[model samples]
Target: MNSHYSVAVIGGGQAGLSMSRLLRQRGVDHVVFERDRVGHEWRTRRWDSFCLVTPNWQCNLPGYAYQGDDPDGFMVGADVVDFLEKYAASFDPPLLEGVEVTRLRRTRAGVFALDTSAGRTTADQVVIATGPYHAPAVPRIAERLPAELVQVHSSQYRNSGQLPPGAVLVVGTGQSGCQIAEDLHLDGRQVHLAVGSAPRAARRYRGRDTLAWLDEMGHYARGIDEFGDADEVRLRANHYMTGRDGGRDIDLRAFARDGMRLYGHLRAISATRLDFAGDLAQSLDNADAVAEGIKDAIDRYIDSAGIVAPAEARYVPVWRPDSSPSVLDLAASGISAVVWATGFHRDHRWIEVPIFDGRGYPTHERGVTGCPGLYFLGLPWQWTWGSGRFAGVAQDAAYLSSRILDARRQRFTDEVSWLAGTPTETYPQVEWWAAA
Candidate 1:
């Protein structure tokens, strides 16, 4: 590939590809570097039954919106990979697959230099669009689990048949944990779900998809300021639901009703036994409270907007016995696999800049980093609640591309003025020089 580019976008996912499309349109010279193939995570990391949590209609990238037949339907894992591949093809982006960017730092000349698997590359500007969820964050207790138990992260999980011939313990109560638990339970495995504090939402509310309601209410457009706390919004857990089973809601209560074992958060794990907290009832109550809050917000929005909507049936929380044991004999339960759906953490160690916050997150103003010409995209709550979603990454990408272009134009103007031995203040109109 090229040794130099005007801009280098790391990661060939939606964010990078969207930026590539916009940069191409603006006559900006750029290249996209991918550690693997485009949409590598969607192609490999996700499970077999995985589908988009969001609707198909919301999968909007720059210049590429969802044109498939089913706007409301959810796309499966492979279909998402195919969509990304087509988007990459649409622009013929200068993407170098199998090239991993190992190091990113500003050189002495004020340009960003990247050390990659292929070779060294330099750029005037760099957009780190590698996304937020970089690596799986399994709890330290995971290491103490019995060696015989097949431990797998949610990303490595593909299908129920991959696990050994026994029950599965799915830790965490977020989307992945709930979906995987449902998957295993449906596949005839006696499933045990360790519950956490994840809010639940009905897939459909008041005769419309919940996402559509959120879109109409501009919930997706809400920024950290709207939430009143950046840390709270950034650290908020995703709701417990799924787009699988044709967008059916995966109620944890429903799981308990279906004869699946429910446990509190996995506190400690010994060789033969696993200890859980006695907060199962409280956890369920918290989930129900949050779920009610969401429904109430929707109700208020409907009333405020004066929209004619039918009353929707409310979901009742599933009740459990108050005297359940906080400890379980893992050996007797025959759980041979442990699925850690504990979410992910970002690893920005390679980035030599000091823009990270106290939580190790890159500090940026809607994608532009504190360091000039350095940017980030596909970050959660970067600009809004939807910033990390498939549709929202492109919005950040488009905004950042404009910033890069503005800086590029100014630099070109300065160069022309300096070459002509004219003062930049006097020769501000250098359109002809830029064109030439």
Candidate 2:
């Protein structure tokens, strides 16, 4: 790669690659820097049975959509990597894999400087496309557990075979937590799951997948700006369901009825003993409510459109805790392994920019920040419900590409005007629009 370029994309994932493809199409000099080999995250972080929760038809990259015969089916872990690989090959994006960018800061020359393992490089603009799963957010209580008991963050977990021969206690009920718990449960390894307040969705309803109906309602296309409570809504835990075994709802109540022990939110830990809040019933009830709520919306949509759809009965809770377990002795209960499926937080500390809020989340309108020459991409709800997802990232990336090109043009015009004895202009503070 050259010492500098018109733009630098600091990730090689879907977002970064999409950005690269757009820039190349526009004839902009750019490069994509990936910290690891291709498919590193998919290969490492995901369990063996991991698959896309959404259907394969939703994998819409820039100019490269899914052409597989099984568009209605879910692409497993390996299939996902292959699709990305083929997309990259289709365009031959300028990418440098296995090159980690250690830090990024504004240079004295008003450009961006990226310090990487290879060396330092400068660029006119930088797009941080590293999606937000940087650091795992395991609870501190994990440290108090017995040293002999195997503990792995949800990212590190592979399969029940890798774990010791005993029961597995999975904490948290987000998508990852629920899916991992199901993974272990399917292996017939007596599983214990700690339920949280994450909502749930139906796998299929009214003779079609729930996602299909939602997509028909234009839910995926709605922008985050339409919401009155975007902040809380953006951070809300994703509804838990699985695309495994030809797509099915992970009914924790069904799991409980099938002999898997379910508990409420984990409260605290003491040595080998663990305490749980008596919210198991409430948690299950809340999840069911959300799932039903989605159906309610879909039912309304069908009625409004005057469509003839088969009616389905609302879900009834299959099992309930006769009495919520308030406490459990890990050693006595035979839980030899614990999987902390708690969610993760973004770690942008390496980016020495002041674009973050007090909580360290990047503040931006869409992907364009107030800070000139700096932008963020692939963030949760960055623009819409699917902003960070495959269905919507291409749109987000295209928006960023326009802003990047606009900024480049404005910078050029300003520099020429300044050298010609006109007063220099500070970069315009842009919000959802390019510099004027």
Candidate 3:
């Protein structure tokens, strides 16, 4: 292998693979560093009957599309891995598998240095394509649950068959939690779903994908700079539903209709027991209230902006029980399993770059950071509606590659001066809270 490349990509998932392919096509010398086997995270996903929320038509990498007969059809988890492998193979991406990047720092000569298990390497540019879903964010309250309750993060969950045979309490209302609850309910596990703010559910309107419509209508595609402040974009984006389509269309509603009890956000877990904020009816009411707020926001946006958005994008109503149940009541229900599908957090302690914000996320514009030659791709909502999706990665990759090429052509000298006493490179140091 070459001692260094013009660019080094620090992931090998769909994003990294796609980015590497684009760079290769541009005749840019680049190498990919993958900590595990190719598509390792997808292989370990807890979903059993999991399918891409996005249609297969949108599953294309930079230069490859889903070659199967069903383009509009959703792909199963295994099929996704296979598709990614094929994509990587087609591009002949220079991938170093099982090479974990332990540290990333800037050298004195204005090059990025990467320390990996394989060895140290230097590159003119670095692309951090490590995805948003790399780390699972489990709440601290999980420790309070009894040891026998079989508490697990959604990442560890596979299918209902892998779960303990009893009533299950799913502690999130996100896509993963809803799908798992539905699956467990169908498998005959008395399932109870703890609803946080009910998520905006995806629904098809007319004959188009909701996301496509959103993108065309400038819902998510609008830039943060286009809006006055980041807060507005964040709020509007939060109102947008995740990729989950519908009740019958997706699995969450099916689980509810099939008799999965719904609860509010988990308050506490007592000895083999769980406590909810309110009764199911009250929880459902709370969910309804949240949905109403989202609807109002969407309506206001349409009314003020005069944008023709999807009409059938309605929020699914939570299953409202005729009789409300009591809080702190689980023993009588026989709930034996609790799945935490809360979400994920980014941990960049191993990255020695000072460009990261206090939240540990890299502070970057599109892909370029304050530090020259340091770039990021595949961040959630990095560019537009398609930013983080498999299909969307190629566009960002092409754009970033062009930017890098432009920078190289400009021959711009490094304007940011290094501190006099500061070391040229630094080792990975754990953040204070992370160490605790």
Candidate 4:
């Protein structure tokens, strides 16, 4: 509600909250503006059974870490919400929930001006921590589907019971699609899945969870710069697996073996019919290949270190589609619902800055942008694999907080120099002189 702040954090998620904790510790003047309630995505977007794909131990904020008994277990959506609530309570961050910042641009004076739902305000610096997922990416082809058929983006989906009484067609093979398909299948509903090229990962390897192995192997800490082509790495899809049912590999082949219909990438949808690419076998094979590839890397790490661990066998496909079904009659199959888990795209149009790339992604190093006093956080691969994730956001916030303070100090030094050089009569009524 203040007319101005030294720093304005543009989200109240883990990223913004972590930055607030650090700035608080450093005695910096900052406020967090959240468009919705804190952790709204975790509280609402996910399904009833939705749990963290990562282990609880990985849920580390700036000062708060998971201290529950089940460090190895995954936290469900409610658990995640509770964790964030507790973290916020611990520090009691200066957060304004339900206050949306609709527009942000640098004023003529070089200060950041924000036109929020409440009113206009300005800040010396702004941390755009709204994250990358803003728009649900439903394909335009969905318009061709019948008006009667139930359709919902993955974000709107909650559980199988929410769907109509009939077969379900889930499009996409990413984490959301796969997990939703499994949710429907387990509830005795027939599920037709349109698989994509998203890779899969092993749930566990050598008697240890693959994530645990990766954490120890320093995979999460590997910076994006470590890759030869960081741009390509940024565009890469995340390896899909599940932490549902206490964490397990989502073997699509096994799902097919159990009568869950599988198809290739969804190409088109005609009246009463749906078309798919003839690459079901390739998709499945590629997913398994990636999963195995991760296992191979873990094996090499264990061998070189001589780490004693249980020996585990590699995965083999349990079932294969006899024929690539390229088309399906929607009416005859009794498919009454469609879930579009096609993922999300960034929506930074509200930000009137010119720092975005062709894809509308902010051009930044770590979190600091080329634009002075502008920064970004909670972006996938922002610095490392865990940069956007709870496991790594603390480090990113710490680094960004230091940068913020450095910028603040530089501004103060410049102002002092200007004041000293100027005549004593000028700036006599300086409103912010005492704060300095």
Pick the lDDT winner: 4
Checking candidate 2 for backbone clashes, the offending pairs are none
Per-candidate local distance difference test:
0.86, 0.89, 0.71, 0.91
lDDT of 1 at 17: 91
Error of 4 at 19 (Å): 0.5
**lDDT tens string, model 3, 1-436?**
5666778999999889988888888888889999997879888965877767776777767789888887666777788888888888896889999999999998776778888998888887889999877688899888887667788888888988887788888887766776677677667788888876544434344355554545555665565566566533432323213232321244343456767776666887676566677655654555456555645655675668887655655555544465544464556778777888888878788788799766666778887899988888887667765678876777788889898888665432221222233343441111111233
* Candidate 1: tens digits of C-alpha lDDT, residues 38-74: 9899988899999998999999999999989999999
lDDT of 2 by residue, 1-436 (tens): 6777789999888889889989999999998999996677888899999999999899999999999998889999999899889989999998999899999998666788889988988888999999999999988889999899999999999988999999899999999999998888888989988999999999999999999999999999889988999889888999989899789998999999998998889999999899999999999998899999999999999999999999988888889889899898998899999999997878888999788888888889998887798888888899987778888999999999999999889977766665466433443222112322
**Candidate achieving higher lDDT, 1 or 2:** 2
Which TM-score value belongs to model 3? Answer: 0.82
**What's the CA error at residue 60 for candidate 2, in Å?**
0.4
Q: Which stretches of candidate 3 lie over 4 Å from their true place?
A: 218-220, 227-257, 279-326, 412-436
Task: Point out where model 2 deviates above 4 Å.
Answer: 422-436
Candidate 1: misplaced stretches above 4 Å?
420-436
RMSD of each: 3.4, 3.9, 7.3, 1.6
Give the poorly placed runs of model 4, Cα more than 4 Å off. Answer: 423-436
